[model samples]
Target: MAGLFANDSEQIDRRTSRSICDAVGERLQQSLRPEPRLPTHLEQLLDELKQRDRDSH
Candidate 1:
């Protein structure tokens, strides 16, 4: 009797692998595009603190 399962590593080609990777990457990029930008008030406060520290040192 022959076994029903076999290894499929030999059947995959470079082109197919690259195509799958590219599709998954595109989906991820689309999902991340709408993320909100950072808050400007927090950014300005951090910059001011850094400048004060630099002047003291």
Candidate 2:
């Protein structure tokens, strides 16, 4: 029953579909950044954790 599973494969060209997806993924990767810099207020909290670790040792 290949016909049951297969329908309208010819509606979209495979190469064009692949290129569109690749371009979209590339644009998203370029626009996204990881871990923005922490604000100054958080610095003290980070320092406290460091001190706690030091004391634990």
After superposition, candidate 2 runs with Cα above 4 Å error:
1-10, 35-49, 52-57
Q: What TM-score, over all chains together, does every model reach?
A: 0.49, 0.44
Candidate 1 per-residue C-alpha lDDT over 13-39 given as tens digits, one digit per residue, 9 for 90 to 100: 889989999999999999889868669
Model 2 error, position 13 (Å): 0.1
Can you write out model 2's per-residue Cα lDDT over 1-57, one digit (the tens) per residue?
677647775456889989999999999988885778788879889999999999999
Q: What is the lDDT, from 0 to 100, of the residue 22 in candidate 1? A: 99
Q: Which pairs, if any, clash in model 1?
A: none
In model 2, how many backbone clashes occur? Answer: 0
C-alpha local distance difference test of each model: 0.84, 0.85
